[model samples]
Target: MAVDLNEFKHPSWITAAGAITGYLLILIVLTVALFIVPWLVFLAL
Candidate 1:
């Protein structure tokens, strides 16, 4: 299925906030998987 860009338009700040939140969420997940989890596992072993 394809997404429609022009449907249900929102304010610009709302769109910006959503994009930033998504970006930050991706960073946080990568950091945890690549760094934090490895550190914890190293300490455990």
Candidate 2:
């Protein structure tokens, strides 16, 4: 199957927004997992 990058292009603003949103989501999840899991484990101990 052939994929075309041009066919997938959105408006520059939309593309930028999507990239920023994806990055924020990754950071939020990482922060929660890194801090929250250890705290929960300590509470259980």
- Model 2 scores a TM of 0.70
Q: Candidate 1, overall lDDT?
A: 0.92
Candidate 2 — worst ten consecutive residues by lDDT sum? 4-13
Q: Which ten residues in a row have the lowest lDDT in candidate 1?
A: 5-14
For residue 22, model 1's alpha carbon misses the true position, in angstroms, by 0.5
Per-residue lDDT tens digits for candidate 1, residues 16-41, read 88999999999999999999999999
Compute the lDDT of residue 38 as modeled in candidate 1: 97
Q: Which pairs of residues clash in candidate 2, taking residues 3 or more apart in a chain or in different chains?
A: none
- In the range 1-45, model 2's lDDT, one tens digit per residue, is 988788556698679989999999999999889998889999999
Error of 1 at 9 (Å): 11
Angstrom error at residue 41, model 2:
0.8
Number of the top candidate by lDDT? 1
Candidate 1 deviant stretches above 4 angstroms: 1-10
